[model samples]
Target chain A: MEMYWLLGLPLAGGITLAFWGHRAHAPEINAAFSLATLIAAGWLTAHIVAEGPVLIGGDGWFYIDAFNVFLVALTAFVAFTTALFSRPYMRIEQAHGRVNAARLRLYHASYQLFIGTMLLALTTNNMGILWVAMEAATLTTVLLVSLYRTPAALEAAWKYFILCGVGIALALFGTILLYFAAEQVLGAGGGALSWTHLNAVKTRLEPVVLQLAFVFLLVGYGTKVGLVPLHSWLPDAHGEGPTPISAVLSGLLLNVALYAVMRSKVLVDGALGGASLAGALMMGFGLLSVLVAALLIRRQTDVKRMFAYSSIEHMGLITFAFGMGGMVASFAALLHMTVHSLTKSAIFYAVGHATQKAGTQVMEDIRGLIKTNPTIGWGLILGTIAILGVPPFGVFASEFLIITTTMHQHPWATPVLLTALGVAFAAMFGRVQPMVFGETTLPRLPHQPALLPVFVHLALVLMLGLFIPGYLAHWYRQAACLLGG
Target chain B: MSLTYHLQVVNLLAALLLLIAFAMLSQRRIVGLITLFAWQGAALATSTAIVAWSTGQHHLYYSAALTLGLKVVLVPWYFFRLIRQLDVDREVEPMINIPTTMLIGIILVIFAFNLALPISQMAGTVTRSTLGIALASVLLAFLMMITRSKAIPQVIGFLAMENGLFFAATSATYGMPLVVELGVALDVLVAVFVLGIFFFHIRETFDSMDLKHMERLREK
Candidate 1:
């Protein structure tokens, strides 16, 4: 089945690369596996569109529906393109003596494993497996983040491990509590842990227990979503890890974690007979993250860290939109997820090359990207403009929908949202403009940078901004409905 | 009557687990903390086994064995080796003193019990009374993590938190499905291994396992 291949390819690639990842052609092999995964994801999306939502494996251990199918395709696509970017980027890292062969093997293998775990987290029907897969994803990336083994890198990785470890442990406690509630109705067994079964009997489940469980689950998974207050690990991990890892961390991993939170929100909403409580908590966290991250963006010296903060800001915006809890808000949230992933990863791709050419991650030290390499410079400028929600970009379209919906629904929060967006736009545009257009004495590197993935992602973002295709719009509507108003 | 007797034994073990969690909170030596962690694991495994026998949930028996194998024997052995190899068995001063940490732990225990009351009242398992203690142990371990500045003690605190979670699962819901239980067990084991690997890397980079050396990374 296409589902099996979609999950199997990255896993198989991880195992194989664990052995052969030190060779000269390992990056290509990594890219090949990612491409295969993307193809399988495409096939699975087509199958889902034709066949409707269905469960896979025995007793439906894997669930595929309109809600997650688009995300699956998006995760796979960005992963493949990030792999292509990493090929030259990592080689340059090696040439610069930052890493040796064995570390690259570790990097490649862990990258595949990380992708597989995230995909598993996305697709698993059982809530317990979702927790397991999410924890596994954290473990793999912890190693990748510390691959350079610098004091800063190790510190970032350790903070990521301990904080996420504690956060996820709380989530498991919540899962146990959920199972406790379900065992009273569904009775004990694996069936008690299945999301499908829990959703069916949600109204009959105990509301008090569900409320406690959702609190723990939100705080637990929200740590991974990089929500404010729990977001210290986000900027550090992104700043210290390899650029490719940063791309996926910002682009795919955060989205997957948010997906988990949203799924839990649905069950909690049904049990509570309204979305009011859950939506309020999410709105509080989301608005706070956007405001905090937007202000913090102005203070960043490292370009990657600055962009990392930008990621938190966008994720916050998406979370706030979802928390608004309407069909229009949910659709806009989905659109934001897609465009943010594409645009953020493209920005990282450009930043990765720019830093490599400048030989440092500090913003002030790097200059004249346009004079050094026009493609990467333009890519950085275009990607930054798009990400800052410039007109005729998908980000602007999604943000427009979100703001208008917020205006009609919750007028009081509009000024806060506008302030955060305005501050973020100014901070980001001011910082990036000088880097892209200013004069510099930087020389070109030996390896030609991979600009194709950057443009490919930006072009798609552009097309999405200008117009929404019929089928994609329909797909978003379906997903929005499933997420509930 | 027999069910009540088994429940009593589970309750006793749960109390012992909480007591040991408090002991871990007050302990200053890294070696003593690891020892306390092992004791906590032993108490958790025994309670899980007793619950399994009383409830007739066959899967929990396997979970108990796993706790015995990994938590009691393997992880402790590995930690002992790690401490010996790293030569970090010195006294670890808490950021907050022992008295302050213990006082905070007591408050957290009270808070946890209050939080768990409504949920525990709804749980149907015979061992449901221990849910509060289970949650308290988790909170106490978290407190220990926060108060300690050394890496090893913090890791032991994390492992102890997992033990508390396992205990909660067994008491409140008779343990998860065998597959999920196995997956959680494996993840914990891998987490320990990964953190252990980082232990050496951190030491190699900083020449000490103290977390204060890791203070360079912050927004400037």
Candidate 2:
């Protein structure tokens, strides 16, 4: 019942908020719902910790394990912080005439719905529900992405909708194929499409069908994960959408998509009898995304787009680590997910404030953030340093594990990973340094900016880097085991 | 009806469906393409109903009804209304010329048949032979989407591709569970309405429905 509340609170709140959020207190209402959702997530996490991995509502509707519980908690936390940040950020956007009152309502409402759909994707054990939730997320984010109603925003939203729509349609076909494969073994209806049941009977599934299904599933979800070759939509969507939406896209939605892929990967791994085919495909795509994003990040003019590519690069590294597939690697990958989400979202929040202060998103146009607003300036620099995998940040810890694991298990791929990370660091810091440390282009806004979310998230990442809490380590271990580590 | 006779009827309808897919690919006018798309859906509904009758799967009758209602009646009605509202009911030029498009469609059909051969043999259904046609229409629809430069035709191609997938589902595995079918139907409806809204936005922004204008958003 509590599990239902964890998913229900935001969903109902978001829908209701949409109708009334245009009033005087939209952001407060938004933040209140988000905080309530976060508390419920914390409560659910405490319960799961107390009692191991509960399945509620019977027969495959809601299943929570260590794997998803961490994600659920992380998603809620990031969403709440972003909602808090969006309050001031969106208000400033309105002041600048970039947004108006009606769009403000749309932003607040869509933001909550985005959180709702992502939570749905995380908690549901039914494969059909998972696909539906993912599609719903795309739709909600589409509204938010085009909320600005610029030509570029509309184009980005259209591209996101079409690409993800086609990709998800293909995934649905794959899910149907998975059902077809499971039907012969588990009978026709009911639990056949259930993940728990499919995972239980995975080994008995026909290899050819499962193989074909995984191919479609990988391409489909890989598009959402921002894997290269299928990732043309990612940078545009991120760059063109509202900054808060960009933060959510980078920080949360991508992780949920990867979580879905990993869910499917576990079954495919079992069906393949520990074969390396699935792993190799992931590794190939992961490497390609990392390399492409690294190279592309340097040439980007839009600050948001640059970080969007950085997101693709980080997701690539995480996907590569997960593809490596062992106790150390999967643990590192999961840790990387948590840290990357934190660090990247922090970076986006700082970037959002800095860009607004500078009155532009063009990298070359903005200058001397430190002289104008030292707090935001340093926040951007520090967040960039953390995301680029400097030490004393959680991303560094996770990247270190990934590198060491790859060195032991995949020596040849190690250099590629190293080179990509190095390039990404140079690209990010090189672009950001000018903005943070040069002569001013525009005067800083008079109002005090919201720097709390940035500092809060960065502090969390720093803490995780310095010390892995006992519970988090144990949680990662249990989740790694679930992934067949 | 005899089982073999019913299977033959499914095969004939499957052929008609593929032919209509090809016709849609080669179609030059927006209204004509919509009409062809409706005919393709009508063919798919007939084939599905025949298969359901032959196999004694009662739910597929409902499936057939849904497909007929959504694909044959409602969606095309929405499209016709949209084209009338948008005043874009004119020539639809392919990015690739018509002859080359037809040639490419033929090749896709052949490739789809080759791809479906091994898989179809594994399917134990009365409509197993139609699996190749289903796959072929899907690929052809994809090809149509690729070759069409106009927004509305590309959307039609997407819907047609969904038709192919639905037909594949029925032929390969007696269709997806009814709940999924309903969800997918609703999703298609919603997607179409959403895209219809986008048509106005695109037209307002660029004063045209050509997708080439969106290419300006690509990374420099």
Candidate 3:
């Protein structure tokens, strides 16, 4: 019941917001709805903590365990904060005539729908439902990505739609294959489609079929997760979409997709008799994505695109950590998900405000953010520091765990990982510092920037860096156990 | 019907589906490509119904009806309407020439057959031999998508590829659950509508329908 409300609130809010988006208070409505959903998520999380895991819906259509309850909470929390940030940022765009009321309605509507689909993807015990929800997310974000209706925006949206569309179609094929494999063992019907049942019977499944299914599923969901060679769509989608959309794209949607991959990875790993073929494949893709994104980040002229590449890099690191497949590595990967979501959303919020003030996303043209708006400049720098894994931030804590664990377990990967991380750090800071501290190139636009969400996120990351609360640590540890089992 | 005769008939329909897929790949005219797509869908539906009838799977009857309604009749109707409204039914020149594409399509078909051999042997379905044809059609549709310069033809290719996947599901594992099939059908419909709207936006943005125009958005 509580779980349904956690899913229902955002969906209901999204529909209502869409209907009332032309009203002057639409942003407020969006914020209130998001806050309501966040509260419900928190309530659900508390319940899970008190009661162990919660499985609702007949045959467990909705399952909330240690692994995903935290993610759901994180998704809602970030959505709420991004909503707060979007209020000011979007209003500024409206003032600049970059958006009209009709577009606002679309934005608010799709924003909620995006949240709903991600939540659906995260919660559903049915693999088919998960794929549907993922596809729904892609569709809604496609609308949002093309919101600006510029040639570039359309191009980005088109590429995103076609690439992900094909990728997910292949994923569907993989899903069907999995069903075929499971049907023979589980004896068909709904039990074969349920995650709990599939995981229970995973070791008994056929290896060849499961291997083929995993390959397709890997390429399919991996496209959504923005793995290298399949990640051409990520930067474009991020660069062209609204800043809030970009925030959610990095902070929430990508994680949901990776979560799907991780679930499938566990099954594939089990079926492969600990051969770790799936882990090696994931590590290969992860290392390549990190290296590719690191190099790509240096070439980016657009601030949003640069961060988009940074997202790919971080997602790669998380994938790599999970691929390492130990208790500590999975723990670190989960923590990385949390910290990356918080810190990256903060960075996007700051970047959104800064770009709005400077009237361009072009980094070199929009200089002296610190000089013109000290709040935004420092926020951007601080947020970037948090993302770049500096000390006293949660990212550094997780990255440190990942590095040390990799050195102990897979010594060969550590140098490559460190070099990629190093290259990414250099590329990011080298582009960002000049933008923050250089001479002001554009006149400051008049607006009350939303700095609250940015600061709030930064503060949370800072707290998490120094200390993770006991209950939270226990939650991650439990999830790690489940993942590594 | 005798089992061998029914299997042969299914194989014949599968061959027709593959031929249409190749025809779609080499097709230069938009309307002709769409017609090829509809024919491919018709062939797929016939084969699915035949498989369902011969095997008595029963659920695949619903699947056959869906393919006929959505693919053979409704989707092509939608595409025809879309092309009519756009008033841009021009030639769809390939990025690679037609002969090269056909040659590549033949190679892909051979490759798909080889790849499907092991999997098809694993599948116990009577229509297992058609699995190679299904895989070939899927690859050929993908090749069409890569070679076509026009957006609508690419979309048609995507739809055709879905047809192959549907056939693959039927041949390999007697089709997915009815609910998942319905969901996928609805999804494909909604995706087409979304892509339709995007077509207008893309054309409006660039004053043309060439995907080549979109290359400008790439990183330098």
Candidate 4:
């Protein structure tokens, strides 16, 4: 019943937006409704932590364990905040004549449906169904990405569709292979595709076959996770799409996709007699992506594109943490997932305002944001500091945990990571802070959002840096057990 | 060995698929590529039917039917319409020339067969040897995507690769469920619609469907 609300509420919101969201008041109402939903989601996630794993259907089809509940809560929280961010953003687009009532309605509808599919993908316990839901999420976003119908937006949507379509096809093939291996043990039926059943039957599944499937699955879904060598589609998608879509792309969608990969990692690690080789593979890719993104961030002049790289960087760090594969590292990875989603979306929200106010995404041209729009200027300032992993931000806590864990496991790997982090920190913040503070003040803008969501997200990051709630910490410990198991 | 007999036949069919896929890869004319794709799809449909008949999985006939209708008939029809509407009979040719693409296709075949050897050994199916050919066809299609400088040929590459996956599915497990086959067929249909729109958009944006020109449009 509770899980139904978790999936159905946003779906209902999506339907309402589709049918009747054209009125001027609809955006405000949608914003408020989503916020209430987020509060409920927060409560439900907290309950899951207190009660351990919650299985809502037969065969544990909708399991909310510690590993995922935090993600659900974080997803809802960012989604709510982004919705808040979108209310002002869309109105600004409206007033500027970029979007009409119809486009706004379409945007709201797709946003909710997008959130729904992502939630479905994360919560479902059937691997086959999980793959299908993830693919559905991809398809929905293709439409959303192309919602503007401009040529570049259309092309960006096409690239995203083709690359991700092929990726999902490979993932389906991988899922099939996994079922084949399960047929040998669990028999050739639906039981082979169920996550709970596979977890139970992992010992009996064939190692070679499982290894093959794992490779395909990782490469396939890892495309969506925006891992290097397979991340080409990401920047274009983020750069060309609307700001709200960019926020969702970085904050929720990518994290959900990584969650899929991590679940598969758990199964693969179990199959391969633990995370020995898998750890090496993930760490190698993670480090490569980190280096690539750090180098790429400085070269980018588009602010949205730059933040997109920051997203890639943070995702790389999380991947590295998980790849390190200890209980401590996995816990840190989950924590980082939560914090990164919040910080990145907040940055995007701030960037959205800056892009509108200065009327450009390029860094060299736009300046004097501190003089022009103080709320947005301060948001960028704090978002940069938080994103750079300053000591008093949530990102700092996660980064410190990951580095300390890496130090224990492979001490030599630490310096390389720190160097990459430092380079990225310098590259991102150096440009961001100056762009906000430097010369080029223009005429003041007429409209700005209520700064609550930005402040709330920044405060959460700050609080996470300072302290974690007791239950969340306990949940992370238990979730780490699941990761190790 | 009686066991390896079906393997040999599967290997032969796979080779045929790869050869045609490579031909499609090198083919400069849009009409020629579509014809190659049709042949590839026909091969896939036939192979799936053979596997299903031999395995006595009646549902596979449904899979074969869906493949035949969607890949062979419907998609090719759409491609022709798209080709006519787009008026792009002469392809711009890929970044790589014909000889180069053919050479890459050969390497892909060798790698695919090597990759398939162990998996085919484990499979109980008589046609398991075709896995290599299916993989080779897939790789060839990927090579086609890499070489082609036009938007439509890339779409064809995508369609042809789906053919390879279908063949592999048939050889490995008889076929996927009827529902899955239907879903993929619908997906291919929708994908066709989407690509058709993209073709017009690409032409409008850059005045040519040449993907190389659009590379300039990549965000710096």
lDDT of 2 by residue, B77-179 (tens): 9999998889888756644578888998899899989977877777777687888898899889888877777889988998998999899889888888776
Looking at candidate 4 chain A, the ten consecutive residues that score lowest on lDDT are: A183-192
Q: Please report, as a residue range, the 10-residue window in candidate 3 chain A with the lowest summed lDDT.
A: A186-195
Docking class of 4: acceptable
Q: lDDT of model 2 at residue B57? A: 89
**Candidate 4 off by > 4 Å:** A9-47, A54-61, A100-106, A147-155, B1-16, B89-96, B176-189, B217-220
Expressed as tens digits, the lDDT of each residue in B48-99 for candidate 3 is 8998889888989999999999998988898888878887776556556778
Model 3 residue pairs with clashes:
none
Chain A TM-score for candidate 4 is: 0.97
Among all windows of 10 consecutive residues in model 1 chain A, the one with the lowest summed lDDT is A269-278
Tell me the docking grade of candidate 1.
Answer: high
Give TM per candidate: 0.99, 0.97, 0.97, 0.92
On DockQ, the leading prediction is 1
In CAPRI terms, model 2 is classed as medium
Ranking by DockQ: 1, 3, 2, 4
Ranked by TM-score, the better of candidates 2 and 4 is 2
Better of 1 and 4 by DockQ: 1
**How much is the TM-score of the A chain of model 2?**
0.99
For lDDT, the strongest prediction is 1
Per-residue CA lDDT of candidate 4, range A1-485, in tens? 66888888888888988888687677776776677668768777867766767777765667778777877888888888888888888788788887778777878887887788788888887777777677777766776677666666767787888788778778877876777677667765455667777888786777887788878888888889888878888887887788889998999998998888888878878888774666777888788888888888888888888888888888888888888888889888888988888888888888888888887778887798888888888998899899899998989989999999899998988988898899898888888878888988478777966567777888888998999998778878887888854
lDDT, candidates in the order shown: 0.92, 0.87, 0.89, 0.79
lDDT of 3 by residue, A1-485 (tens): 77888889878988898778688899999999899889989998999999987678877888889999999999999999999999989999999898999999989988988898899899988787788889889988898999999888988998898889889988988898888788888875666877888888889988898888888888999999999989999999998988999999999999999999988888888888877878888888998998899888889999999999999999999999898898999999999999999999999999998888877899888788888888899999999999999998999999999999999999998989898889889988988999899987576768889899999999999999999999999999999998875
Least lDDT summed over 10 consecutive residues: which range in candidate 2 chain A? A185-194
Complex DockQ per candidate: 0.85, 0.52, 0.66, 0.29
